[model samples]
Target: MRTSIATVCLSGTLEEKMRACAAAGFDGIEIFEQDLIVSPHSPEEIRGLAAELDLSLDLFQPFRDFEGVTEELLLENLYRAEAKFALMNRLGIDTMLVCSNVATATVDDDDVAASQLRRMGEVAAGYGIRLAYEALAWGKYVNDFEHAQRIVDLADHPNVGTCLDSFHILSRGADPAGIEKIPAEKIFFVQLADAPELSLDVLSWSRHYRVFPGEGAFDLTGFMTHLVRSGYNGPVSLEVFNDVFRQTAEERTAVDAMRSLIWLEERTSVALADHGGAPGNDGGFPAYPMELATLPAVAQPTGFNFAEVKAGDSGAVEELLFQLGLHCEGRHRTKPVQLWSAGGARVIINQQQARGLAPAVSALGLDVQDPLAAASRAVQLKAQPVSRRSQADEAVLQAVSAPDSTEIFLCEATGDGTVAWAEEFGSDGVVEGEPLITHIDHINLSQPWQHFDEAVLFYESTLSLVPRASQEVPSPMGLVRSQVMCSSDGAVRLALNIAPMGLEQPHGGADYPQHVAFACRDVVALARQARQRGLDFLPVPANYYEDLQARFRLGDDMLDVLQSLNLLYDRDEDGEFLHFYTATVGNVFFEVVERRARYDGYGAPNAPVRLASQYQRARSGRRDG
Candidate 1:
């Protein structure tokens, strides 16, 4: 399978887009006409440059509004298509994409459309080119792929064939199973794109909101499976027009585009293998069997091995950890780092060695069944491997850099990295009491506006984590979008947060506060103990308890107990949740949570209260860590 991407999906000049695409290992490219028209390089020069970079100029696109037109307008359209055909010949490209008419169509008959397309195909043949007719979701007459294929059949010309676009077909609820009925030779090309499920105008949605394959809600695996089962093995290309991709860095956008395609291929192959073939539909797709390359299975994260925080001044951070029932176990053998452990939760504090590096989460360690297999899967999904200096005696943990610039260390579940490294801390394991805080419940990660979707796809593809639908969170400042990703067996959890569009730096250069939530059997006991240690908890307002009383209808005894302990309360159809927070420790904080009766949520209804308290602290002249 040859991989291809359109030039319009990236940001930069045509030359820069080409260089990024080639560097990302794409084998072919679809040159949008506007990109060519605005280029400083001539047609021949661009052609030579593509050859030098080992890329095939697969398709020159988008000859639009040519079919289903008046006879006089048909003549005018033919004359216009001739000029584009000449340009394609000069650029050493053979295929041109002809979209169904969205405007200027006085005739709406399929016979009229077919006759016009046949004439266009004859003219294209004169220039040694082929016409791949595509149906726009909002086309006046041919708005469906079946209708487009019918017209292609009526045309009965050698050079006129139909193009299949996943967005156009899937967005309008068109059935893709009919693709297997069409002959392979007539399926000229395929353009793949995915979009979120939205209620909007089709034209505007296709032009502005199209995302790469794994980033959206489309069933691309089913779509691609049907197409490949039909015996069409041409270049699978991407034609996305996203507002975010057009403004981001060209190299990053190109790499993301390529990664999405790679992920799609692997996912579709796995789906095929699992189902034992295509869904049976009258020799529909089961006729053609697909064999795809396989990689190691992805291992779900077992538990958090450790959470590392880096700061210039480590004294205050250590005091805060100690206050939360975590005692310093020991120091690293070769580095200036200390380990703090509770019941099963571990925290690492590393003194900053690099100047200007803010105090924040720099790395995370996750326990997995097979560390090497997990690393191999990550590499196949296009995650960048991170290299860290290590002594010969220390275990070399497999690591990768996430899109948020945090190193993800994968350690063996049973031994070695987590247990063996404890000896290097240079202390025997002895601590106070079976601590109230037991294990990590979840971690909240803040993402920039542009990197949010990419980060979602990265976590979903690289770690086999499942993404829940995004929800709007009300904040004192504005609405924040939050999405949760977790393992199936309820072991690993991540909450990804993205600020409103105009407020990327929502807190005036304040880093998005990263908080670690620990699970506890008795959160009240943990809160009382923390208060005794002189921990400054984020103060919740009195009005919050009143609202909670009305929402849950709890007795006065339970309500007074919650208010006294400074705990937030929430309840769903399933169960109840009680959680409390600590003050910000250099843009990092801690939360102790007790989940009852299978409560799965993170108490999102109480977020406004927390935000209000944090803002109040900032207004009271508190400094950011």
Candidate 2:
């Protein structure tokens, strides 16, 4: 696929944006007119720079409100378009994007609009240029793409055709199946963007909330499938107008944009394969004029092998784990790391090269069917390879770095659920007791505000994990936005959270806590044993029990036991959930959960109370200090 992006999608000077795009491997870019108007370099100079960087100047956009006007206004618009045509000639671009008349359209007659477009097309043809007319979602009379296409057909000029914009079409709930009816040659250009389903006005939503594909709620795979079936082989470009993308680092945003296109191409390819890769009566899936390339296929991770924490002083973390019934199995022979385990759940405490950093959940080990293949696929999708030191005697794990700089190790899945690297730890023997925790239920990772969406696409594309709809949880500071990504069988779950506005800390300090939750058969029994071991539970407020009783109408005995143990309880149509949290040790904490009868939630209803309790405890600790 020929990938392109618009200059308006990034944050930088025009020159910087071009450089970032070229570095990110985009084949071409559509120059937004405002970017050119503000550039110190002339059109010819910009053309030279694009050539020097080995990039193509695909199109110059956004000539707007040129048609559906009176005679005198039509003449004036023609004069204005002629000037842009000369400039496009100078810039070495052959096409211009003319959006449907959103303003200054005195006449709503199709013949008038077509006549004006034909006149403009004559001017464009004189300059050896084409016009890709597009419909705006909020256009005065030409809001629908079909309406714009009808106008293009009436004009019957070789220089005039339609520009298919995914945002413009899908945002209006327009059916894309009609695209196949418009001959492929008349489809001059295509622009792609995905957005979450929002109830706001279309203009507001398109202008500010557009996200990269796979990061939003849009079904872009189906959109691309329809576009490909239309046999339009033009450059598939991105034209997003997002407030967040405009403020982030241009290089990072450009890379994220490229990754989105790569993912979209792969998804579209799979969709085609599912249709038997042949044209049929069902949909007539003809041979694609444009070939879509795919990546190395990988299955979703089977489960989490271990969660690793790094800290300067491991005493607090060690004691906390010990109190939770996880004993230190053994220390690594060559590294300052110890493995703590109880049943299938494992935690790694690494004290190596952690001189000044706060304790944090820094890495995760995932069990994949084939680690090498997974790593290869991740690298092809622009993930940075993470190198860890290991000797010949040690197991060499393939790994990659997530957008948040967390190292993700792709460990080989074992038949008996044993980790190969665990043998490297010189353990005397297994500890004697019934296992308190069975395995890891989930891990919550806090993301930086700017990279939250980027992290979502990263996990979805690289790991093949599916993202659930996001929700907001109220905290003491503000609202916390949380999204969950998990495998199909519910074996691996990652809860990604954007901290409430005022709670984010620089360098990921203890100010914002992240926790690892373990699944236990009986959380009440585990909580009782932890209390006897002097574990400091995150205290629950007295009012929480009263509210719980009111909500669930539990008997007195049940509520009393829950309150005495500082445990939280929740129930749904499926089953019940019992869980409790431990006090924060630096930035890392622990949770023990018992899920009954296929209850597959994270107890989201109790999140507000937990946040309030943690905030109150932190404030009280400050006063005591």
Candidate 3:
């Protein structure tokens, strides 16, 4: 099916929107009336420009409030629509979308609406144009698509048919199964949009909160499945009304829109095939008849490559690493960088003079099946590619920058992946790895509020990771939204936490919290070893240990061991998790965790206690001053 987008969905001038849509590989465009009214280009010039861009002018919209009115008002609306029909001819657009009346409707009779719409259709037909009547969810009289369908059926003109918008149907909680009941020929055009389930006025929600498919809570896979099964194979166009998209870069937003359509089409096809019978039939469904290209199947990530830390004050960061029991393997042969290792976990400390002293996590290295294929998929999903200069023998890694400006490096999954880069490090002798730490358990990244949803969609669509239902945890300051994305095998786990709106910190300070948790075979022994290295564990209140004993009814020996080590413990039905945190090193921190008996959580119940402890420590230092 052809892909198209509405001009209102993007920012910039009409010409800019056209260029962006064409560059993003859209087949056509729905020319919104407001976009044309505000443009400098005449209708003929717009038509010529679209032709040069190889884009079809799919539809001209919208002719509104043209039905269900008094006789005089109805005649006035018809005359107004006739003017638009003439404009569509000049713009070389055959189809016009006339939305059901939202206001100024005096008549409630279907016959009255049918008569008015039929007159408008006649006017459109005289100009060799078509009319697609849509039911807006907030329409005064005809809010349901079924009601609008009845009016169109009554009008019964060749140029008159129904326009189906997924948002209109789904936002009202209307069953989309009725779409299959409508004849394929009567389905003149389809508009697609996805939205979060928000409790607000329908008009407000539709205008301010609509997102692209796969980015929100809507069931777009099922929605598109209904459309495909109905044999309504027109351009599957996006008509988003998002405040963020309007302010974002037009080119970027356009690319993101196209990616959503591609992902939606493939998912719809898969859903149809899974049904296992005749297409659109209630029984086992067959493959969808529409043709769409499928992306390469993403292989689950096996492990992490390396976690990179960049600090203007590299010495402080290096000291913290030593306290965490990571040995400094060696310095890079050419760059001012040091490599730290503990069993399977590796950290690169970059102290280039050009970088600032504010401590931050600059990059994440992912171990994947095919680094090139992963990067290709990211490109297809509109992630920005990043390149770095390297020497002749240096290993090349695929990298991209996420929306939050975090860099991700893709490296080979197994066998000599990081070892190949050892030639760049100066050390010749083998560096002994730490015995306690096994691998990276998980990485937690704090995101700004505005970019949270975009980040979620990026990880899901690009890396093929699944997102768990988001949870809001109460924090000392406000509620923090935490979303986890992980692979099927639990190899790559990322926790994306978002600060509540208006609480975003300035860049370069403690703008966001970032932490790397290292898996350990034995937390008790590792904590003892780490303490011997002069590690200052984040203090846990004495009351916490007392409560832990009371809550779990642990024996005296276990409670004594946990208290002595400053460890936090949590138990669920499946298993237990024992973990401890190091004092904050600028905005970054470190964690050592041991998961027992299929424990998958990150000890969320302990977060408030941790935050309070950190706060107390800061307050103590200020009082000492």
Error of 1 at 511 (Å): 2.8
Model 1, backbone clash pairs (residues 3+ apart or across chains), number:
1
Give residue 409's lDDT in candidate 2 (0 to 100): 95
Per-residue CA lDDT of candidate 2, range 1-625, in tens? 8999999999999999999999999999999999999999999999999999999999999999999898899899999999999999999999999999888998989998998999999999999999999999999989989999999999999999999998999999999888888899999999999998899999999999999888787788888888888888889999999999999899999999999999899889889879766323236545777888888999999999999999998888988898999978899999999999988999999988998777889999999999999999898888889998999988999999998888999999996998889989988576887887999999999888888999999999999998987999998888989999999999999999998657643213534678999999899899999999999998899999999999999999999999999999999999999999988777888999999997989899999988888787776663110
Clashes, model 2: 0
- Candidate 3 local lDDT, 413-504, one digit each (tens): 76654556745776535656547888889998888665677788888888888898888776556687899999888888999998655333
Clashes of each: 1, 0, 5
lDDT of each residue in 1-625, candidate 1, tens digit only:
6789999999999999999999888998999999999998999999999999999999999999998887888899999999999999999999999999999888889998999899999999999999999999999888999999999999999999999999999999988999999999998889999999899999999999999999999999999878877888788999999999999998888888888888888787768656666333344445343344456786788778888888887777787787788878889889888988887788888874835555577788888888899998888767889987779998788999888888899888984334667667866467756788788888888787888889999888888889998988877678888989888877788888886654334343556777788899898888888889987888888899998888889999989989987899999998989999887766677888999998999999988788778767766756355
- For model 3, the superposed segments whose C-alpha errors exceed 4 Å read 275-289, 352-354, 415-419, 426-434, 501-510, 542-550, 554-565, 612-625
lDDT of 2 at 529: 91
Comparing 2 with 3 on TM-score, the higher-scoring candidate is 2
Query: Which candidate number would show the highest lDDT if scored against the true structure?
Result: 2
Segments in model 2 whose C-alpha atoms lie over 4 Å from true places: 278-285, 505-511, 622-625
TM-score of each: 0.96, 0.96, 0.90
Superior candidate under lDDT, 1 versus 3: 1
Among all windows of ten consecutive residues in candidate 2, which has the lowest summed lDDT? 503-512
CA-lDDT, candidates in order: 0.85, 0.91, 0.84
